[model samples]
Target: MAGAGLKGARERRVRTGGIELCVAELGDADRPTVLLVHGYPDSKEVWSEVAVRLAEEFHVVLYDVRGHGRSTAPAPLRGGFTLEKLTDDFLAVADAVSPDRPVHLVGHDWGSVQSWEFVTVPRTEGRIASFTSLSGPSLDHFGHWIKSRMARPTPRRIGQLLGQGAKSWYVYLLQTPVLPELAWRGPLGKRWPKLLERVEKVPAGDYPTPSLPQDAATGAWLYRDNVRARLSRPRPDAFAHVPVQLITPTGDAFLSERLYDDLGTWVPELTRRTLPAKHWVPRTRPDQLSAWIGDFVRTHEEPATRAPRPVAEAAVRSGVRPEYAERFGGQLVLVTGAASGIGRATAFAFAEAGARVVAVDRDAEGAARTAEMARLIGAPEAWGEAVDVSDEQAMEKLAATVAAEYGIVDVLVNNAGIGLTGSFLETTSEEWKRVLDVNLWGVIHGCRIFGAQMAARGQGGHIVNTASAAAFQPSRALPAYNTSKAAVLMLSECLRAELAGRSIGVSAICPGIVNTNITATTRFAGVSDTAEEKRRQRKASRLYGLRNYPPEKVADAILGAVLHDRAVVPVTPEARGVHALSRLAPGALRALARWQPPA
Candidate 1:
C-alpha cells in the first residue's frame, strides 16, 4: 500500500458492501475534499499524478474500487459490480473521507461511468458537490443516444451508430464469458502496459500496478452485470443534481465526440473541454488535466448559493465565439508583436476561441489597445506587455512574469518582424542588423523563453512563427527581408523536429503580399535621401493596398496550422503557388526574382 507511488499519502481502510476498500488521503483534511475514483483495469495509483497536484489546495482522496487494487472483491463475480453497488461504494467512501462536508468528485473512464450514477441518483444528493468526468459518459444517456439513433435510422444517425459501434469493438470482446478473464490473467495483462505506452503515449512506470491481472480478470463483471440491462432499459430519471465538467479527449479511441451532443439536455449546468490527446489522458496529459481539475474544483468550492457559473453561460455572457471553443477555451496564448497586423488579428482570433491572451508588443499603447479589444472579443482574461522581442533579457523577464501570473503558456506566436527592401549589394550592414534583429532574433528569443516554460511544464504546446513568401521564393529587391524570413522558416523546421517527441509543435506560417502596415514602414536601402525612402515606402504600401488581401486571413491560417500541427503553411494563393514552384521550377523562380520593381 505504501509503495503505490502516491508520495506523502495517509492510508486507511473503509468497509462497505462486504468489501474492504483501500483509501489514501493527501493535504489537510479540513480543506475542500476532492475525491478521485480510478477507472477499470486500474487502481488508486491511476490518480497518483493528479492527486499530488490537487493536494496543494484541497484535501485529495483516492480509493480502489472493489477487486481493483488493494480492495477486497465480493464473494461472487457474476453480479458483484452493479451500478447500485458502485453507488453504495461511493457513498460509503464519501462518508468515511469527508463525513461533515460534500466531496467534489473526479473520475476517469469507468470511474466516471459509476460516478455519474453517484451524482445522478436521488439518494446521493448533497453528498457530492460537483463532478468532473473524463473520457467517459453516463450509461443511461449513452443508452438513450443509441436508441434514438437506431430508431431514427437516418443516414447521419446510422453512420454515427456504425462509427461508435466500431470504436466499441473491445466492449463486445469483454462481454464474452470466460475468454476475457482468461486473457487478462495470461499474456494480455503482461503486455497491457507496453501496449498503452506505444499506442496511447502513456509514460511507462508504476501505473497499471501488479494487481492488474486479477483486477482485470474480476472487473469483467462490471460490464457483464450492468451494460446489457442498462442499455435495454436505461433509467429515464437520470439527471445531474450538480454542475458537471466533461473533459473529452478528442483522440479517444473508445468514444466518439458525438456521444455528448445532447448532453446539455441531461445536465443543466455543463462545461465542455476538449484535449488533443488519446485516451489514457491521466498518464499522458496530467499537467493540463490537473490545471483544469483544480480550476473546476476551486470554482465550485464556493458556497452552493454562489457556485461559479457554467462555462457555456459565461461564454454567452462574454460573447465568446462558439467555433473551436472546446479546443481553445481557457487556454493561455501569448503572442509577440500583437499590437498590429497579423499579430493583432491572430490575438483576436484566439480571443474569439475563448483563450486567455497575453498581448505583447514593443509599442505600449498598441499592446494595451489590442488587449482591450481581445477582452471585448471574448478572452476571459487579457493583458498587455511592452517588450522588444529582439532583447533577450526583456523576453526572459516577460516570460517569468507571464508564468508567475498566468501559468504556463499553451500557445506562443512569434510574429514580430521588420521589413527591408534592397538588392544584396545595396543593402547596408545597419539595415541587415535591424531586419534580422526584429525578424530572426525576435523569433529566437520568443521560442527560447516561452518554449522552455512549455517543455519544462511537461505538457504539450504549440509555437507559430510568422515567415513570409520570400522565405522560400527568392526576391532580389527584398534581400534583407528575404534572408531574415528564410532563417525563420529553417529555424521553425529544425525546432519542429527537435520538439516532436516532447509534444511541442512548431509551425512556420508564410504569407504572400497582404494589405498591412509593414509596407508603410519598410526601409529602402538604396535611397540617397529620407524623402526618396519615404516615397518608396508609399509606393510599396499602395501596391499592397491594391492587392487588398486581409491580415485576418493570415490569422486564420496561423490557427489552422497549429490545429493541424503543420510544419510549413503557405497562406495565400500566390504563396502556395510559389512554394510549389520553388521546389519544382527553380529556374522560373530565379528568373522572377531578377525582375526589379518600380521605386
Candidate 2:
C-alpha cells in the first residue's frame, strides 16, 4: 500500500564482495524488487526518489556503490574500486537482495556500466530481468569513441587536445600518493567550491557537497584502474545478453550524445530513450523518467498473466515518439546571468532551437536587451527579470512566480558566477565567503526550490550550474575562486546521488574563458592597488584571449551535456588540457604550477 506520509527512506549497511555498501530501501519486501546502483563519487541516496516511484510497483533497493556515499572503504582504498570488483559487489548485493527472483536493475553513470556487466555475466544473468542504464557507457564503446574522435584531421586537433587534457588532470592527480589526501583533507577541501565547481555540469540538479570528509580514495581507485589504464583490457564476455534500456539526456557534457551513435551494435535488444535532461538525470528528470519507465514497461515488457502479445501487436503497435521529433519545441527556459556570456548566448541558442526564454540577470536593462535579441532570433517567448544571483530568498520567490505564471519551469540555468585572480594569501575572508555564497550557494538554493517542485509535478526538468575550469585543477594563485568552484562541483555530485530516483536532470558547466564580461566585474586582491595583481590579470587575460571562443559555443555545449546527461564537461582548450594532465600526472602539474609563470 502507498502510505500517506512516508518518512525519508532508511539506509541499510551491508557487505557485498569485500566492501561495505550503504543500501537504502522502500516498500514491502514481498513486492517485485528493483535494485538501483549509483555511479562514481556518489552513493545510494541518489536513488531515493526513483526508488519511491518504483516502490509503487515493486520493492526498491538503492545502495551506495562501494567507496561512495555512506559505504565503508576497504583497506588499501585505491585497489577496491576497480570495475571488476564493483561488478562483483553488484552481484553480491543482487544475491542478497533478491536471490531467487530476477531483479529489475537500474544504474546511472558508473552504475550503468556495472549493471551492464552484471546482466551479461554468466553467473549474475539469472538474477536480472531488466536493466536500465542512465548516462552510462560500455567501457569498450567509450574507448572506441575517444579513439575515433582523435583520428580526425589537424583542424580538429584542438578538440582532441582538449579532450585529452580534460581527462588527463584527474589521472595525473592519481599518480600522487600524498597530494590527493592533502587535497581532500587540507585547504582544497575547504575551498572545494572553486576547485570542484567546474566539474559539476549535469542538466537536472547538481550533486550535493556536504562540508565534510568523504572517502574519495576508493572512487579514485576506479579511475586508476579504468580511465588511467585506458579501458584497453577486454571486458568480460558475458555482457551481450542483458535486456537493457538506455536513457541518454540530450545535454550531457562529459559523454556526448554522439557516444550513443553506435550503441545498438553492442546492445541489440536495447530500448533507447532520450530526455532533454542533463547528467544528473535521476534528480532533475525523475517524473519524466518515471512516466517514461511506466510506458517502457507497458510497451516492452511481456506480462506474466497475459500470454506474450501477438506478433502483429508487438511489431506494429505504436510506441513513444522518436526523439528526433519536434515535441521538444517551445519548452520554457529560464537562464540566469543572461545578458552576455553563456547565459545570454544560451538564451538565444534555445530561441534558435524553438524554446521560449525567460532571461534573468542583475542587469535588468541588459537582460531586457538579451530578451529583445532572443525575440529577434525567433523565440516564441522571451522575457527579462532583474535579480541578484546570490540572494537565495529572491531566487526562491522568483522560482515560485515563474512556476505560478508559466506552469512549470522546464529548464533552469544558474549561470551567474564571478572569477578571481591571485594566490590564496591574497584572498580576504570576506572575498572567499562572497565567492562561495554566490557561485556555490546560488546553485544550491535554485536546486532546492525548483527541484522540489519539479519532483512533485513528475513531468521532469533540467538544472544547469556554471562552474569553472579550476574545478578539477588545484592552483595556488586562484585558491579562493578555485575553492568555491570546487564546492559547487561537489555539491552537484552529491545532488546527483540524492535526486536521481526522481528523474530530475542536473548538470554543472565547467568552461574556460569564453569571451565573457566577467573579467570587467571581477573583484580580486591587488587588482586596483597592487601592480603585481593587475599585471597577472592582464597577462592571464591576454593569454586567454588567444582562445577567444564565443559564449554561444559554450551554450551549445551546455545543451549537449544536458541532452545526454553527461556528468563532467570541459569547455575550453586549457580546461581540457588541465583536466587530462592532472589525472595522468598530478605531481608534474603541481611542479608546473609551482614554477613561477615564465617571466
Candidate 3:
C-alpha cells in the first residue's frame, strides 16, 4: 500500500457524461502531455510508478474513470462504463489538461481497452497524438481476429483461438450479472492485492486505492457492456488514424500474444515491443515502461529534432539482424572489456539492435571510442567508463553511477579478463594471483554488484560471463588461465540456478581460440628470456591468426546464448569439438593436456 498514492500531483475534476472524473497532473503543462489510463479494479494510481518516471520528460496525466478512484459514479452502474462513455471521459480530461496540443496516450489493460476505442474511432482522431498499448487490444480488432480464425479453422488457427479463449476466462466471468459485483464487494476484494503481488509481481505502491471494492464491482460493467456486442459485430472502419506502439507482455495471463499477430493490417505506422512480464506491467516494469514510453512519445512529437542517423551502413557492417532489434531496442546494456575484440563486437551488435550501451574497460580511450561508434551504429545513447574489473570498489562505484545515470541495466556482460600461460608447477604465486584477480574475481565483482542491481529491480535481466574452452578442455600450456576460467564456468552455472527464480539468466561463453590481441600480450611463465617470451607470444598470435575465428561470431554466440538462455556456448569449431570430447571422453582431454608445448 506504500506506493498507492501519487506525489506532488495537482488534482482537478472534469465532468463529461453526467459523472465527474478525478484527474492528476504532473510536470510542466507546456511539454507534450502523456495521458495514462488505468484498467479494471485499478485507479490512475496504478500508474504511480510509471507516471512519476515519465514526468521527468513530459507532462504526465492520470485520471480515475468516472466510477473509480475519487471520481463520481453514475446514477446506476449497469448502464454506464461503456467504451463510449470512457471515450468521453478521456476527451474531457484531454481538453481540460492540454486543450491546444494533442496528448500521447498510454494504456494498460482496461485503460488500454478504452484507449484502443479512442485511437481508432472517428471522433477522437486529432486529439490523440500517439498510442502505446500494452496488455490490451481493440475490441473491434479482437472481433475481426476471432471471425478470421473461426472462418479459417486450421489446426494452428484453432489452437490459437482455444489458447486465447482459455486466457479470457476472467473476461467471461466479468460478464456475469450480480455475481462479479457481489464477489468484488465481498471476500474477493480483500484478497485481490496479495493475489496481484504473488501472481503479477506488481510492486506494492500507492495503487489499488481504497475504492478497489466499488471499482471492481462497477468495473464489471466494462465487459458486460462491451465484450459480447463488440466481438459479435465489431466496427468495420476501425483502422487507427495515428501511429500505434504495441507493447506486448509475453507472460500476460489475460491475453494471448497471438491475438495481435495480424495487427499490421489495421495500422499504417506500427512499432512493436515485447516485455517479459505478467499482466500488470506498469507496476512490475516501470523503468522499462517509462523509458520505452518516453522514447516513443519523443520520436513522434519531435521528428525533426530526433532525426535518423546513418545506421543502414552500420547495420550491414555489424551484421545485425532485424529480429535482435525487436528484442533489445531501448534496453540498457553494459559490457566490460568493451574496448576491443569480442567485447567491442558485442557492444556494436547490441547498439545496432538500438540498445543504450555502456562501454567499460581499463583502456579509457578504447572504451570511449567503442561508445562513440556504438552511438554511430544505432544506440540511442552510449557512454564510456574506465575501470579495472579486478578492483571491487571501482566496480561497485561504476554500478552505482550507471544506475543513477542510465536506469537499471537490462543486460550485463562480464567479459574482462587477463591471460596467463604456464604449467601449474612453474607458475609463481604472484602470476596466479594476477590471473585470478582479473579473470575469476573480476567476474565475481561484476556478477555480485550488477546482478544485485538487476535482482533488486525485480524486473528480469540477463548476465553473460566470458569463459574459455580451456575450462573444459584441459591445457598444459595454460594452467592459471584454465583454472580461473574453470572457476568462472562453475560460478556462472551456480548463479544461473540461484537467479532462475528472480528471472535473471546467466550464460557462460567459451571460445577455444579466436584472433584477438590477448594472445599478443599473453604472459609466458618459466621462460626467463624476454626475447623468447616475445617469440612465443608471436607464435601464439600467428597460430590464432591461422585459425582465423573472428570475434564477431563469438559476439553473435553471446547474443544468441542470452536470447535462448543457453547455459554453455562453445564458440569456434575447436571449442565445440573440445567441449563434446570432454563430455564424452575425459581421458582423451587429460592425455592431450599432458603433451606440453615446446619452450
Against the reference, the lDDT scores of all candidates come to 0.87, 0.68, 0.87
Instruction: Write one digit per residue (lDDT tens) for candidate 3, span 430-516.
Output: 999999999999999999999998887666789999999988977888889999999999999999999999889999999988888
Ten-residue region with minimum lDDT total, candidate 1: 305-314
lDDT score for residue 282 of model 1: 80
Error of 2 at 199 (Å): 8.3
Assess candidate 3 and give its TM-score to the true structure: 0.90
lDDT of 2: 0.68
Q: Which ten residues in a row have the lowest lDDT in candidate 3?
A: 304-313
- Compose the digit string of candidate 1's lDDT tens values, residues 443-548: 9999988888777655568999999899987887888899999999999999999988778999999999989899888888878799888988888888999999
RMSD of each: 5.6, 18.5, 3.2
lDDT of 3: 0.87
Writing each residue's lDDT as its tens digit, candidate 2 over 213-240 gives 3645446566666764545543535345
Model 3 root mean square deviation, Cα atoms: 3.2
